[model samples]
Target: MTDIEARFWSKVDKSGDCWLWTAATTYGYGRFAITKRQMIGAHRFAWETVNGPVPDGMVIDHLCRIRLCVNPAHMEVVTNGENVLRGEGLSALNARKTHCKNGHEFTPENTIVTKNPSGNGRACRECRRAAWTARATCPECGGSFSARNLARHRTNQHGGSHV
Candidate 1:
């Protein structure tokens, strides 16, 4: 192995946590501490030693199940979304709740599909109707449009127009 690789491997603790060389600088910052700096250094060392370089749009995950441990052997590269799903712990996995914020379960009878640039998604029609029933004035001009047409009346009648 090269000198840099050799130097990196020499800093691992018995627990597999990587450490930074006292002489090494991070992002031009100063020496590595045993705690915070060591964790960051370990991640960097693991990436550099095994992967050579970390490409953009990729994240290193701790497969060894230790966030502080930085053994290159324990690290794996994955997408950010996958990392989040993996890190969400057990609660998300066990969660069976799919209701809207207003307790509207996403059933075909109560859900409506709206087409947006992002694609079609389910919306609770009951919530929309309830929200519509609670409004009094046009949000744009303060002219009365009732709860039903408040949003549309604002855009079509009062939008970009004074009074």
Candidate 2:
């Protein structure tokens, strides 16, 4: 075996289904030095060593969910977005929601997708309209107005004091 391969295998504990790396790690992922100034994920190295280069626009995902696992059998290549969706992060959790917090089903008609600096987010149209309606009722005059009209109503009718 080559020097690098031997060095890599020497650090792995293969007693179980997931081959765990027993070396340096960062953020729960095993790290390996491939060159004097370069490091790579140990799992990635293990995968490439056995299966070949990861496909373009694809990343390695650990099916075993163990970041330190270097077993190529426990990994799969997938798109970055697919990887995130399969994870347990906020984005994945939010994407898995079939209904809003107010028990409104996320039907196409009841859902409003909003684009922001972070990313696209889903909002319930009924909940949003309800919130707007609640704010649209003028407290001073007890008058009902549209959301846009409420500010003008408060200004013109209430002399801008309530606004």
How many clashes does each candidate structure show, in the order listed? 0, 0
Q: What local lDDT score does residue 86 receive in model 1, on the 0 to 100 scale?
A: 68
- Per-residue CA lDDT of candidate 1, range 28-134, in tens? 32223444435445575667767788778988777655555556666788887677556655533423347877888878788887878854456788998887677
TM-score top scorer: 2
Model 1 TM: 0.44
Tell me, by lDDT, which candidate is best. Answer: 2
What candidate 1 gets wrong by more than 4 Å, as runs, is 16-41, 63-65, 88-97, 106-125, 134-163
lDDT of 2 at 118: 100
Model 2: lDDT equals: 0.93
RMSD of each: 8.3, 2.2
Tell me which residue pairs clash in candidate 2.
Answer: none
